[model samples]
Target: MENSSRDYSHINGWGIDADPKNDPTYPMKKRTNEEHRGYSWQRPTQQAETVEVLHSNERPNLTAVFGTTVPPSGLSGMLRRYAFKHTENEYAHWLPLLLADRINVVEGIIEDFKNGKVPNIFAEKGMKADLQHDRAGLIKKAVIGGLLIGGVVAFMAGKNSNKSRKLDY
Candidate 1:
């Protein structure tokens, strides 16, 4: 496991090993001739030492970034309570603004139509689309293709059979 906390800039070749498959330990220490300066992580380290270092008592959400807090839960609490919360006691402070925007849009559209800015969508020069799909024709084509494929398979199977045909008088 990777210790997602500390900056490993001080440690060189932090989590590398000759054979990662053999050594299933985190921060796989590279054996170097460097003298240990009384550092726990220094010199050729053990798997137990790596495990101990990785597993720290530091709380993840001690500073509100690791998503371990209660109340509103996770980042949602940060947004709703701290960052983007309405100052007022109302449930939805943006409701009025949202409704206003919708009304303004509708009014703008109506105004444009009155001033002849918004042209008729059903105009003679307007581009038309084939909305009426031929569902029956599509189904018929699919059935025909399936039948043809099935017939070919059936014919091949019958033709390749080693059984002798008996002629009835």
Candidate 2:
């Protein structure tokens, strides 16, 4: 009669060829694929090796950008913190769009001045006085545009702050 411990099978090429009776850890109870959630049963040796690799804490966190550190918990919190820190510590940077707008207004003012009208404020500061006088309309227009842009930027900034707070995890 064939010994039950000496029975061996290699159904899906798992390489379990050696006699089970010779190994102390072999001839163990095995589970079917459906019983282990579609995973084949592993030998004791292979399972030990896999467990050792999984328990090792040698891998680095992949979420952090260069020169930044991230905690293992809650990724969204870390991102929000990093963004807030970056924006808060950095100096105010001039945006190209805003600079372009200012340049356009200055050019408009120059054109208006060249039309024989300069702002009276220039003369009030003890400057040139032979300037013509139709600059009031141009000055008022520039001031109104500047104020509108500033208000919009302020409103959007406040709205963003509130939204960011609401999204905090």
lDDT of 1 by residue, 69-167 (tens): 223332332334332234344545345435545555556567679898974533432323222355566567668989999999998888666343433
Candidate 2: stretches off by over 4 Å: 1-133
lDDT against the true structure, per candidate, is: 0.47, 0.48
For model 2, how does the per-residue alpha-carbon lDDT over 1-169 read when each residue is reduced to its tens digit?
A: 7756543355564444465665565534353435456556543432222111111122332222222232222333333333333333243222332444455556556767999878565555433322344466656766898999999999999999999999995
Model 1 residue pairs with clashes: none
Instruction: Give per-residue lDDT, candidate 1, residue 48.
Output: 31
TM-score of each: 0.21, 0.22
Which regions of candidate 1 are displaced past 4 Å? Answer: 1-7, 10-89, 119-169
Predicted structure 2: lDDT: 0.48
Q: How far off is residue 80 in model 1, in Å?
A: 22
lDDT of 1 at 75: 35
